[model samples]
Target chain A: MNESNSPRLDRQDLGKIALVSLRAARMIMESGGRAQVIAKSAQTVACGLGAEFLGLRIGYASLAISLGDDANMITRMVVVGRHGVNHRLDQAVRRVVQRITTERMTPGEVEVELDRIAQTTPKHPPLFVAAATGLACAGFGRLLGVDWLAFVPILLASTLGQHARHYLLGKQMNPCVAAAMVAFGCALISSQGAKLAGSDTVNLAMIASCLLLVPGVPATNAQTDIMDGHPTMGSARAVSVLMIMIFATAGIWLAGAILGVHP
Target chain B: MIEAVEHLAHQAFFGGVAAAGFGILFNFGTRDLLWCFAAGAIALGLRTLGLDAGWSLEAASFVAAACLSVCVAGFLHPRLDPAPDMIALTGCIPMVPGAFLAQAILGLFALTSPNPDKEITTVVLSVEYLLRVAFTICAIGTGLAVPLHILKLMNFRGSAAE
Candidate 1:
């Protein structure tokens, strides 16, 4: 009983886990893995500790992982999914602190769990997506002779709005929101660009460039994984992310179509 | 000599920025940045000297960057806390086929005089670009891991000798 009572984690162990997890997250992103992989991976790692998987959800650009023990004790980990200058850092710190204090675990153990959790969390592509979109929009805006600065706000609004919509509607509602925001943003920027530059060039450039912002590259990565011999895990991840992307694309296209914005 | 240096320098700077952007996007470290820059410089110099075989130049540069990054990082270790992701990501970014993707998409959407051959070629080019990016990434990763292991061995040996 006394042996069992020993602390489950120490500070050093936590640090190691954090380091490992951070590295893992880095690897997953670099390797083009999906976001769900992170949560799934973390769950796998946490299984050793007898933590039960509850569910994972993305809320306003944050990912929440729910866990429960066999005895019904519950805990939820809310992690900053994307890299943001202010809010993300704050949330990450808060989650880390909460995990340490609430679990009655030592700093080391907490770090380990946090690290594992971070590692297991899939790569956040939305941040990059936003940045890329911003760049593409700016370039297109310039081509169209519109004020490039205007697109910046649109980008930020769409990114933030998408996150809010995701949280409210859950995963199922993501595609619609993604599609609408993208289409609306693109059309607004393009129309404004056309007016300013008095040239259709800007609209054409923006429309074409925006294609680069699609999630197809990573979808291809998922396909590559299956081709390269990680079928079961690859297929599971591939199908899930593909569905999300499809929905997002559909949403954006729908908005464009409804707005009567044609290429 | 001056013209060559100027050209190499130009490539290095642009390559460095591209590489650095890739690093940040992928979460690499400062050491990766340094190594990537150095590798880019060296690769640009090599290419200037007329070693134009695509795979050879790419492979060599990647290996050079990985090895250099590991050595520098290992030597600096605790002090530098070099972010490997940054270096690796940036190092390869310059080589990614952005142009190919653009061409492919443009060909697919061209409304007038749609040429099937042009579209096919563009598509093939895009596919090739993707494969090349993947290969370079894998090669660089291996290059990084191997040298670090070697450095660890040397560190252990030196300590034992002392």
Candidate 2:
């Protein structure tokens, strides 16, 4: 009864939950949960912390959340730090969300788990990512019904493009430019296979290699964002995807121009 | 019909394999790879069915994407990650406009060349390719989104107080 009656303790606990909940939303966004997921999860965290109402606003790189009844309310705004997809981290956040709401984990416990998850490296190593990129592109070549000879070039170009992407992104290069640069490099390398083999092989290699640079995530997000009633964010993402595509095309064109390979 | 079924299976297998590979690049959990394969196989298979039924390519893609989103958001992610988009987006890898994108670029190159002697046939073909590429992008997005919206409305109501 004393535990329930202590208003000061309750206030402190609620404050901790609000802070951690805001952090939870930021983490979710940073790990690839879109605005809708962030909004929903933030609200849930706030609710589990005994909020009567929750107001959440999600943005491209930031989120603001307010929780609790009118007079005793708390509001927090957190800046999303990183924007990369790591499903394992996303899973950890989900685990935290579930535990807090269901098992009623305290704020301190949730923070510890969140920190541990943050420290855990991505399950898929860098080598796997590069190798998988090559395999995926080659697989796409087979799926496209291209000749068997295209595999060598596709493999080479895709892996190289992927590495280039990793390096460029790590350097904090703009995604649009990174995509174009990666595409150009891939096309240039793939064009050599054309020179060695024939036009058919070059066509297949070029298509497969370019597939590695395709902005599937942004395009998908644009759609989801629009449907989720955040049309402005969706439009922005759609336009960004378009810009990336246009830049990638420019890269391919430049490579073709240099290599004297048209079509 | 047997031939069509064979073709469909072939498409599904390659599409699934390719999507699984892309999943690795996206850092999906090892366990989620199989789910990605299923998403790709089902999406491509459904798209093929729609095409065979005389639907437009965009229409087929839209339906296929919806199926994928439903599977990912409704069934798959609940057991895996919170972000269904991760695997679902990778699943769409096989359906990307790879060939069409290259064609459109080639067409644009031919059209944009300073040489005035470019063929009229080239201009016409480039326009077709560009339009198709644009439409396909739109189709993939809208397709992946509609089912997601439905799922969100049904499940994610934000505050538990609601």
Candidate 3:
């Protein structure tokens, strides 16, 4: 005769699960895994805790989820549905408590699930795309009277700018600030390259490569979101993306001015 | 003649494979890869047909590729939702203005610092070059979007009726 119904997850098990999740996220992000693949991988890894994986978007909201197998395995699964930072933080705390109370799961099981998820996450090709684009730009710069030495600055600036944006995003910084910072850093580097290399080729490569970092796709997605009838969400995303782009552009302009590079 | 065709085919294959690989990396399914390859192939074929009317050639090839993608999407939607990002991204790769964009930025630096006249001319050239790049990007995006939009509308209507 069971009178009480309470969900339980051992604290050790929960900590292990969180570790696995974070590791999985690191793998996906580093691998340039697409959203779908990441979602699928997350789901597979969290299966041991009878937890499901949900899809993550650029913004904090719009998390999509699917129920895991093993129905009635626990009292209740605390799904961190579509919510903001507050909700996510709450969910995290709750999950920790739940895991502490429940029975522990084997680490080997968790590792195996994580491995499976890693195998499924797709490799991102943007690195290759950027490299190819850089090479082509270097060639074109030479044709346009840019010196070979100029390519180094451009390469460094563009790559650094991209890496900075990624780092800022991971830290949950304001999108606008991230974009601006990345663009500005890229511009500063390019200008320095110009001065050092005594050629504008590096500047050319940096500027061109940095253009790919513009939040164009996100802007487009915001438009699509609006069209799809999510006005509030869409507008928020659009405005945020716009601000980011503006900051980025301004950063570049300001950096150029400081470096005494003519517009 | 045989060797020439083979060589062209090889280049086309590499281009298509590279584009398709990009699609897969972006999480696009097999259908996207197929449509992108088809688009690339069509663009190559059009080039062989002597359609060298400047920007018109690029326009026609892109539109053709986009329209073909729409058709493929429509035909395959019943089976799967083929990732739009994959198709659009890969299909547009052929027309990306990598060289032009680089040259434009370089041209910006080439402007004479002391001489206003030469500087003005260089700035104008840079602006013109950037505008062309913008146009090319917009054209490819629009070409892909329009057909896909139409297909979506049709599917919406079909679902509504059912």
What are the clashing pairs of model 2?
Answer: none
lDDT score at residue A3, model 2, on the 0-100 scale: 28
Weakest ten-residue segment in model 1 chain A by summed lDDT: A82-91
State the lDDT of candidate 3 residue by residue for A58-101, as single tens digits.
Answer: 22243323332223221112222211111112222223322422
Highest lDDT against the true fold, candidate = 2
lDDT of each: 0.41, 0.73, 0.47
Model 2: residue B10 alpha-carbon error in angstroms: 3.2
* Superposition error at A224 for model 2 (Å): 1.3
* Tens-digit lDDT string for candidate 2 (A1-263): 11233234345566776778888888877766666676667776766655543577777667777765535767777776646666677667866776666665667887888888888746776667877888888878877776667777777888888888888898889888888898888888877875576546675577677787776766666667777778876777678667777788788878877877764
Model 1, A160-211: lDDT tens digits are: 4334433444455444355445544554554454545555444343343333
TM-score head-to-head 1 vs 2, winner: 2
**Compared with the true structure, what per-residue lDDT tens digits does model 3 show for residues B28-77?**
44444576566545444443332333446447545655654575455645
Tens-digit lDDT string for candidate 1 (B1-162): 787667556555545543443333343344444564554454344433433344464476455546544644455444323222223333433443333333333333332334445656656664664465445444544454455445542121222123
Off by over 4 Å in 1: A1-263, B20-61, B68-73, B101-162
Q: Count the backbone clashes (under 3 Å) in each candidate.
A: 19, 0, 9
Off by over 4 Å in 2: A1-19, A51-54, A72-75, B1-6, B52-54, B69-89, B98-113, B116-127, B145-162
- Provide per-model DockQ scores: 0.09, 0.56, 0.09
